[model samples]
Target chain A: MAVWLRSLRYAAILLAFTTSAYAESDPIGYVKTHAGAAFVDAGGETLEAFPGLALREGDVIRTGDDGRLGLTLLDNTVMSVGPNAELVVEEYLFRPGEGELGLGVRLLRGTMQFISGVIAKLRPEAVKVRTTTGTIGVRGTRFLVKVED
Target chain B: MAQRSGMHGGNLLLAALVAGLAVSACAPKSWVVLLPNEDGSTGRIIVSGPEGQAEVAEAGTAASLDTAVPETFDVSRGEIDTTFGDALQAQPSPPAVFRLYFELGGTQLTPESAALLQDVLNEVGARPGADLSIVGHTDTAGAAADNEALGLERAHFVRDRIIAAGLKLDRISTESHGEGNLLVPTADDVSEPRNRRVEIVVR
Candidate 1:
């Protein structure tokens, strides 16, 4: 009986841990500019995207055929995602002087505009954008990338 | 004469300066790592291209990646123009800007601007963590100094309202352009209603 009770308690704790991780993650970016039918997916919940709405890691942003979004990360990198685009903030870290700096994004489909910010300026290798085909590394400046489905 | 000796000393100083500059110029170029801040982003771009990987930084600098058989490359900012122009142009938009007009020499807002307050406040509240630049302006009326002071007062008044509307104080900055930058440029001390205003540019 004790063994069974302990296993049940373990399962309860695991459930609680997963629930909090998905629900209360800190935001990593925000919707600076958006139009049309853009939406943000926090874990599994999808909500319409609006300007100034907070974004977080593992969060996926999808824009309808009539939608577009401009997101500025905490590190100041500006990304403009085009219509019918899906972008994911896979990982981001922006503590400059302390050397904790990274920005990893996945452009799942459609097009993405990248303007490298402080994270890549401080350390070039720390910032990387991945598409199904290959990766985009920033030395600095702005660039555009499109992914074919 | 003392004049001749002074000229000799000056020539020696000039030579030393030239030597110093030459020595510094011959020194090997070094990479600069920019720290993150409120204004600009870093200048590094690295891409894995077919002819090995390439990296560039800054607009007018030179960087050598490999020492063996070294070749310097222009450090112009990197940009790739794939076929995303049409896609981006379909939805190009700028950040929202709010303009508020004020009465001459007073912090009181005009009737039209008073109505705009709700929308301004709502916009600020909606854009959480956005940085704002609040600029105050005045008609060419009154002494230049007083107009500047009045403009400043008006800007401060607007700033306080935005902060009271739940915007972070640190994110908003107030500036008084005074009567110098009039919307309707006029003769000095002219009371132009169009010139008196405060602008809240939210970024």
Candidate 2:
């Protein structure tokens, strides 16, 4: 009976730990609105900012004065966009011990720069950045991308 | 006869002497005249003195004494530019002393950050007629456009918060430089807290 009770106790502790850990990675603020042009890390490739490019973990975003931008994933992958860029944060997760880490980014227009980070390293498949071209995957360790029309 | 002959001869000698003295008294005195030579002409001279007459030729031109003299006059002209243009071109300003902060990947205001904002606001409000520009910046973690927008949003957010706390909106303007004006450069793997901030430029 004592052995069974110890097992139950362990399970309860594990449940509590899981719930609390989930709470920490919540976003404090989000991408309100980016004017002109912007860029996002769409799956693995970079998306030029148009209307709704979102932000995700391990995503690096940049904008030019005339509206150019570059987006990079956490692993140092890159995506460059041109003038009047805008981006949005669609989905993101960075909870420890959850065994799951994902990030999503969308580019509206302009330029972008994306660099990979924790999420891309821990869960390579979970990382993605969306752009006008489509969702890009972080296959190579580091890369540069530019989109314009 | 002898006495008469002597008288006649003496009378004749006296007459001759008188006549010679009269001729000497009638002659005019002579004067020496010297004239300066003109052009290539030669000089002529006359001597009335007992010595005799001699003429001297012209000497060469006199030399100037300007090389030995030093300047005595001093003058100053043109004014220095105290306006913004010259100062901006010659010397760009260093980064501001205080900065604005945000919660990680989010816009939520933490108690520590709230207190910091209050301090900045108080510092600003305490001084009247202090026009300020609230510049926002972000780290290299996000996309460039996103970072630019993020920077601008952060700046505007702070501006709104300060205005909500009784500060004048008219006294402040917002500028988002994004990651273009980074305080510290960071590697692709690391997240630098210093670069993720807002600056209050008090003018």
Candidate 3:
């Protein structure tokens, strides 16, 4: 009886984990300008989300040529993703006067420079910038990111 | 006029009391970790919570960067190689080598580089008693001083991640060789991708 009960509890935990993973939102805005091929996991298969494709955090934004991409983050952080650039929003959360906000991104490919704002400054720990090689736990500051092939 | 002056004083006192109380109510639970720059500067102070994760609630409470974060370091001018040589000799082999590539004047590690880190981490985990030595190298780009610091930062970036991943703090050593050391030497005028890298080796 104890074994059965433990198994049930494990199943419930697994369900909760899978549910949270599905909660991520879709891209709200499209790519402003893409010099190279930009692919998106449209529905299931990877489809091209080129110029005019709406973009959001967590969207795989890539540049074929040495191009650039402009993304408007949830907190209105304007991120200019550079060519051969790959970036992802790992997590983003914002809370008002209580001063709690979380911004997390992973830079996979090229370069990205951030200008911190209310969200990033109010709760700097809420912001996390990750890379293939490492991660940057940042606050309200200006910094640049360059990822290579 | 005297009565008005007295009232103003009382109001000011009340305001001050309220502000003090508010600050106390919202003050963040704080902790500080000294993040040394790859360069030789005093380094950065990363204030966070129990897990070293930045607490947004305390972002305002924690101090801002008091001074410039060392963005660059040089091996030739800084005699940094000596520090690294000593560290390498004493350090254990890294479980794996995490390879990185960079763009010109850039400090970001690309996707392919990140994937490489995953493998490196696995290798580190597989081997017990292994320490990591993060050696950074820069291309013969701009000035020697700039490349030196850039290489150091890249090495630090790797070291910090390994620490964050719950590795033993004492198990890792880091060093940066700016533009002074290159895998593919250019003729004083070329930028090579081979040089811009942070290599993770088991000690």
Candidate 4:
């Protein structure tokens, strides 16, 4: 009887997994370099950010006054977020071979360093970074930005 | 007259707060910088603020987007901005490539490949903090989908062999080129021995 009940519970778990809401989000990047106190706010759960931690869309990276974080995306684009900053990753898609490419991020406030990857290099106008003031368009090179109140 | 003076003082305080916020808006720090990548490819950065917009085109350049008029400075010349100095030092060296061929439609390596691992071992031993990139390719004899899987399988085989040979690298990326990028160009559905191979790029 216990075995049968355990089998039923396993089937229920399988059903819940297969029928869960389909979300097309994967780890778009990883925290390649981390220092001091940085946190990832995902679904309102603030987890301590570390190197190699996978990052996804709808995630916000909040850095303490002494924290700094570096990331490398799938397209090899690298980013460095400075101290006392809040950076949000809205969307990311990079499939250069099939030509489906995009990169979108919002910097609420703080300092950021961006190095263009394959998507921005291939399609000169596909990447967009938005701050509270305005939107930035990439033209295939490196740049830095800081948002202040 | 005294009550009126108090009202005026309150208004003055509110105005001072607003002025303080505005002053902080454009207060420029030292700078934010983007250094050159090791791979020789360049990246451009665009800054759009309330007052104006500016873009930077060169590597080793910096922008302090203070007051919306983004100013570019040559940070790499004399005194580096202490914030980005570490990132500049972390730039990768140019990649060094090693190739190993495989037999047709299988993971089995040719007899010559036995000596090829020694070369990879030597390179890994020499470089202290090098990253490895393994890319597998296949001939055009099979379906494109199947060839993709086969290519990855072959690359994984090589990756595992490298790991087993005792190179404890933390970052190793594996990819499959399938029937693309032929060393010797061939027609459709052709079997080229050289195409069935894996290329290892140590950087």
Native-to-model Cα distance after best TM-score fit, residue B186 in candidate 2, in Å? 1.3
Q: Between prediction 1 and prediction 4, which has the larger DockQ? A: 4
- Give candidate 4 misplaced runs (Cα > 4 Å): A1-24, B1-34, B39-43, B49-55, B59-80, B83-100, B110-135, B141-146, B159-177, B181-184, B189-194, B199-203
Q: Would you list the rank order by DockQ, best first?
A: 4, 1, 3, 2
The number of the candidate with the highest lDDT is: 4
lDDT of each: 0.66, 0.46, 0.52, 0.70
For all predictions in the order shown, the interface RMSD in Å is 9.4, 43.0, 18.3, 4.8
Across residues A30-129, which tens digit of lDDT does each residue of candidate 2 receive?
Answer: 2222334444453445655432233344444545554443322222223334344455546667653457577666655433434445566677667665
Model 3: per-residue Cα lDDT at residue A84: 60
* Residue B147, model 1, lDDT: 83
Per-residue alpha-carbon lDDT of model 1 for B1-203, expressed as tens digits? 00012235556556556544543443223221121212354355454422354454553333222222223332211111113433344332233567788776798899999999888887766664576668899998789898889888989999998888777665566878888887887998788888889988665
DockQ each candidate and list the results. Answer: 0.14, 0.01, 0.03, 0.35
Better of 2 and 3 by lDDT: 3
lDDT of 2 by residue, B31-105 (tens): 111112223343321111222322222221111111121111111111011111111121111112467677655
Model 2 stretches with alpha carbons more than 4 Å out: A1-149, B1-96, B109-111, B188-190
DockQ for candidate 3, C-alpha atoms = 0.03
Candidate order by lDDT, decreasing, is 4, 1, 3, 2
Candidate No. with top TM-score: 4
Error of 2 at B158 (Å): 0.7
